[model samples]
Target: MTVKDLRIELTSRVVMAQILPFGLLILILFGLAISPDLVVVGDARRPVIEEIAPGLFWLTVLLSALMALGRAFALEADDGNLDALRMAGLDPAGVFLGKALAVTVQLVAVETVLGFGAFVVFGAPVARPGLLAATVLLATVGITLAGTLYAALAAGLRVRDTLVPLLVLPVLAPVLLGATQASRDALFADPGVPGWSWAGLLAVFSLLYLGVGMLAFGPLLEES
Candidate 1:
């Protein structure tokens, strides 16, 4: 089922169509706005990229992921494919997992490009490369899982485009905070401050949503 979902998204290439250009646009806009210009004080100069990089990276990801997630169930609804799946008797949990897996894959790809773009454009060093990678992986899973869940909740609604973000972003406050702080820690923390705790929070959120989605998706899909 996961493979089927992945194939559909990849073959259609619509998910990538939404993620790549929008993600790149964010990176370019932020890069231009921030500019990494030097600030002068007492005959010393410093770039502000470090100050903005963490928030900028996460913000770009949030916006781009939002755009992608809003369309998660839309493909099914728009094409009358949801009925096809229901008729096929596919397990609703499997359907949810499949959709989430496809979204997660798309998000991870977007993040990979955005990560490099942040480092290069913002001049933010990967202070802890391994920790940064782990944070991204865990945070992405949490985000995609929760986003897919909420997107489904808003499915078949005329206002879902607006409602999806409204529903998902508030619930993702912890994810935004955890991922941003963890990314900040990974990119700029003092040598002694531990980053594992934030990554753990992301993991817990991902697992919690995974459980909820597995249990709730069947009922939710039935209703839709």
Candidate 2:
């Protein structure tokens, strides 16, 4: 199931061509808004944008993920594929995992592009590669899990285009907060902040949503 969904995502022109460019454009717009001008600090100087780059990067990612979620389920809903999958007796949990994993892979690719854009456009440097990687992994998992669940819930709705974001974004506040803090610490090596602790929060968030999606997806699939 995972492989099938991933193949669809890889070959889909909308996912490959449109979604990625949208994410990059958001990053570029953020760079323009923040201005990469260095400001004086206690003993040195840092780009004003660097201070906020982590948040900006993650914001871009979240917006992009919303679009991806819409596209993923829209394809299924529009093509009557959801009903077909239900009739085929595929395990709902398996289907949920497959879709979530595929979305995660897509978001990872988007994040990679946005990461490079952040470095070049925001002048942010990575000071702790390990922490940054952990943050991205855990946050991405959490985002995809919760997003997949809500996307399914909203799949049958006429307002799903507007509803998914309204349903999913509020629930993802912790993820956005944790990812930003952890990424900032990773990029700046903030001595006062415990980036690992924020990463742990993200891990917990991912696990909690994973269980929820696994249990609830079956029912949601039936209703949708």
What does the lDDT read for residue 163 in candidate 2?
90
Tell me each candidate's RMSD, in Å, in order.
Answer: 3.1, 2.8
Give lDDT tens digits, candidate 1, residues 98-142: 988887787888888888776666657667988888999998888
lDDT against true structure, model 2: 0.85
Question: Model 2, 207: alpha-carbon shift in Å?
Answer: 0.3
| Candidate 1 displacement at residue 200 in angstroms | 0.8
| Model 2 regions lying over 4 Å from their true place | 36-44, 190-192
Q: Candidate 1: what lDDT?
A: 0.80
Error of 1 at 132 (Å): 0.7
lDDT tens digits, residue span 7-63, model 2: 757656566578889988988777666553422122233645556778888999999
TM-score of 2: 0.92
**Model number with the top TM-score:** 2
Which parts of model 1 are misplaced by more than 4 Å? 34-47
